[model samples]
Target: MNKPMFGIDFGTTNTRIAFYDGETVELVKIRNPDSGVDVANIPTQAGFDEKNGNWHFGFDAEGFKQPKDSMKWMLLRDYPVEEISGTESKELVTLFFHHLKAVVAEARADEYEGQELSHAVLSIPVTFSLEERRALCESVEAAGIVVEQIYYEPVSALYAALRENFRQMPIDENLSGRIAVFDWGGGTLDIAIATIRNGFLYILKRDTLLRGGKDFDQIIVEKAMQDLKSKYNRHLDSYIETAYHQKAADLKKTAERIKISLQNRDNFALNYPRFIPKGAVNPPVEEDINLNFPVLKENLRNWIGKDIEQGIELLKECICQTGIPLDDIGLATRCIILAGGTSNLSLIEERLLEEFGTLKFGPLEKIERVPPIETYSSEPRRFFSSDKFGREDDASVATAVGNALLAADGGIPTFTCDIGLIVLSPTGQPYPKRIFQEGSPLPIDKPIIRQLPIINRGQEVISIQIYFQSIGYIKGEFEIHVDVKEHTVEISFHVDRYRILRVSGTGKNYPKRTQQSQDAIMDFPIAFRLPEKLKT
Candidate 1:
C-alpha cells in the first residue's frame, strides 16, 4: 500500500498512532521540538460534559476532573456503529477521532511541513466480529482518512516489529515449520498458529479468549473492595472519590504494573497512598501503602497465563490429530513466528520450550529468536506528559504497532483461511469434493470447478448447498450456513502434510461472475481462530 499508509490503535486504556514510511515503522506521539518531550500513546480516558455531550480526550480530558462530568471508556472493536456500556460507539469514536484529528492537524502543520494527509490504517482486536469490523470501517470513514486494509493485530506485529529489525529467518528450503502465537493483552488473550509456505503467510489455526489485564484488574479490585468493606464494617460508598472508584482505578493500575514488572522482576508492589474511612470525607488512615507480590516461577504458574493451559492443550490436541509428530512441524513448513501483545512475557518462551519437550520436532532441529520484541510506546501518556519512554513500560501495544505496519506495507500475503457452508444437494460428492486438499501449500489451487450437479432438465432446477467445514482442528464442529440457489461459493483453504487444517473454509457467494472471481459476495473472512486440532 504505497502512497503513505496510516495505522491507528484505539485501545481500552490507551491509543496509539503510527504510519509506515515505506521503509520503517515508527510510533507517532506528542514530540516537542524545543523541550524534546516525547509523550506518545496517550491514555484512552475521555471526559464528557454533563450539559452537552461534548468530549475532551487524552490529557485534556484527564486533567480537567469535575464532579459533574464522567470519564468515558473507549470501545475497542471493529463493529460498525454499535453500543458500549451505555454510550453509542459511533458517537464515542467520532469524539475520539475529533480530538485525534486536532492533534494530527497540529502535527501536520508542525512536523511534516504541512502536507495534507489522506490515507491511514487502524488496528483491531482479533475478537472483533464482522459487524464490529464494519462499524470500525465506518468510524474510520468518519475520521476522514482512507483505510486501505485492516490486519489482525497479532500478524501485524511481524510486519512492524520483527520485519523492521530482523529480516532474516533462513528463507532457504532447509528450515520450515509452524509456530504457536499466544498473545495476552488488557482485555483478551488470543492464541494463533501460522506457517509461512513458499514465501507466503498462512494462519493455520487461532482463537481468542476474553480474559486479560483488564479482567485481572477487575478481579483484584472487586476482591479488595469486598475485603475492605467487610473489615471496615461501614458503608464506603460516600467516599466515591478515594474509596469506591479510586481503589478500583488504582488497583487496575497496580494490576497493570505487576503484569509488566513480572516480565523482568519476579516481584513488584501495589501502591496506595490514602485509606479513606467509612462515612468520612477526609478521615484518613494512611501510610506508604504497598503490597509486594513476588511473581516467582510458582506465582506465574498460578497466575493468569495458567488459564491458557486448556487452550494450549486444545492446540496440542489439534497437533496430535494430524498424526504428524511434533518433530515434523518445522519440516512441514518453514519457521514459527511469534507476534502479539502478551507475548512479551518471559514465561511465554519458557512455557513453549517446556511444551516442545525435546525441542526437536520432525525435521525441526533448532528454534531461533530473531530480535527482542518491543512496543512502540511503553509508558502511554494520559492527559499528561511523561518523563521518559521504554522505561515506564507497556506490553499490549504491539498489535497496534503491527496494524500500523500492515497499513504502510503495500500488499498483505495470501492466507490459509477458508469459509464453510452446506450445499443441500440430493447427494454428497461421490469423490472427496476436494477443490482444495487439506494442508496443501496456501494460495490454494483454485481448480476450474465445473460439472457442479444441478438437476435442470432431469426434473426441475435443482440447487445444492455446498457443505463448508474446517478439518482436523476439532472432531467436527464447522461453522455451518446455507448456500442458497444462484449463489456461487468461493473457498480458501490449506491443510498440512498430515491433512490437518490450520485455517478453514471461508464461504463467499456471488450472484453473477461478471469477470470477477466466482465467489465475491457473502465474503466471510473468519478471524484466524485455532480449533482443537492444530494446537501444540
Candidate 2:
C-alpha cells in the first residue's frame, strides 16, 4: 500500500491538515492538549516555559503565561534572527512541525498506527519566493515530513470552494468561467482571479497585501487604549512597557472579543473586572483596572474601514489583471468566493456586495444587528458560545481541503501565470514573446520550440531572458555559448505536472561543425520568481 499523502495548509496564524488516500478526503482534526478539544485548526505558534524548560505549541502555547513566539515568517524570509524562546527561529519552526507531525500521527493512529508519517502536499501564499518555500519545506522535512509538492493558497482555496458549493468535480467539463477568491487571513490578504475551462483550473492573476485580520485586531486594541485613557485617566502603556506584559496580552484578547462581538451586534460592553492585576500598578498611582467601555459597530467600521477599502482596491487590481472590467465584474465573474477568517467582517461583505451586486453562486448575508453580549456575568466568556468564528464554518480550512482534493486526484491545475522570453534586439530593444499563456493545462507533452538568429556576427554567447506574469523574471537568463559558426540557437520549453519548467537549448550547427554536442537543459520551478531587473 502507498503511504498516505497529507495536504498541509501552513497558514500565518493557524495551520490545518488533511489526508486523501485515493478513496476519501479526511479533514484531520488536531487534539489540543491544553483544551482537550478536537479542533480542525491550531494557531501557528510556539512557546517555551522558562521555569520548567518545556516547549508548547498551538492552543497549548497560546495559553502559556509567557508571550508566545510568532516568528515563523522571520524564518521563512531568511531574516537574520538571533533567538526565539532561547533557541534559533528555524529550530523553533522545526519543533512546531515536529509537534504537528506527532498530533497528526495520533489523530490517524486508529488506521495508520506505527506507520511512518511522511509525504505532504503543502500549500503556500503565491507571493512566497523560491528561497522562502525551500526554507519552509526544509523545516517541515526536518520534522520527518517529506513535502511532495507546494501549491498556491488561492488555487487550493478555489478548488475547495468549488467542491463545497457546486459539487462540481474537477473532471466535469461542463462547468467553466471566471472566478475570484478573496482570502483574507490573519497575516495577509490574498486576492486571486482564475478561470475554469475544459475541466482545468487556471489561475490568471494573484496579489497580496500585508494587512489582514491581525491588523484589524490591532486597530481595535489601539482604539480601546485611547478610550481607556480618555475615560478613566489611567494608562497601562507604562506598565506594558515595563514588566506587566500579561496586561497587554490580556487587553489584546479583549479587543479581539470586542471585534468579534461587534460583528454580530451594534455595540458590545468591554467589561473586565481587575483587568490589570492588582500588584502591577503601584499604590497612589492607580487602582486595579476594572475596565468598562462600550464599543460600537460604527467604531469598528471607522477603525478598519480604510484597510478594507485598500483590500478591495487590491482585489479590483487582481480582477483587472485578468482583463475583466471592473464595471462588468458581476456579469463576467461566475462567482466570488470569500475565504479566510477576516472574510467574516460585515463591512467587507457589504463593500463587496455593493461593488459586485448579488453573486451568481450565492446570496450575500445581510448584517443583522443583535443585542450585545451579556456583561453582567462575573467571569470572562467568549463572544460566541460555539467557539468557531467566521463564515461557512471558517473559510481558513478551504486551502487544506482543496489540497487534499488535489492529493486525491480530484482536481487538475493549469498555469496561472504566463511564461515567456524577452528577446533583445541589436538596437538594445526588448520584445517579449510568450511561450505558454495562462490557462494552459499542466504536464505538457510536447515542447514549444523557438529559433533565434544570432544578432551579431561571431557572437559567442546567446542569452535567453525568461519572465513570469510580466513583472518578475528569473535571475540569470540562460546563457548558451557556441564556437562552431552557428548563426542561430534553437530552444524548447515545457512544463511538467509539478509545474517545473524544462528548457533545452542547442547551437543550430553544432552537430555539423563540431564534434562536441551543444545541447543543454535547464529546469526551473514555475513558482520561482525574482524582481524583474530587465523589462519583459
Quick one: best TM-score, which candidate?
Answer: 2
> Where is model 1 poorest over a 10-residue stretch in terms of lDDT?
376-385
lDDT of 1 at 399: 59
TM for candidate 2 is 0.74
Lowest summed lDDT window (length 10), candidate 2:
376-385
lDDT of 1 by residue, 469-517 (tens): 4532212223323234433333334332111233233323422421222
The reply for model 2, stretches above 4 Å from the true place, is 1-3, 31-36, 52-54, 63-69, 76-83, 109-116, 168-177, 232-237, 243-250, 261-266, 269-278, 282-286, 359-392, 410-461, 467-536
In the order shown, what is each candidate's alpha-carbon RMSD? 9.5, 9.0
**For candidate 1, what is the lDDT?**
0.46
lDDT at 227, model 1: 52
- TM-score per prediction, in order, is 0.64, 0.74
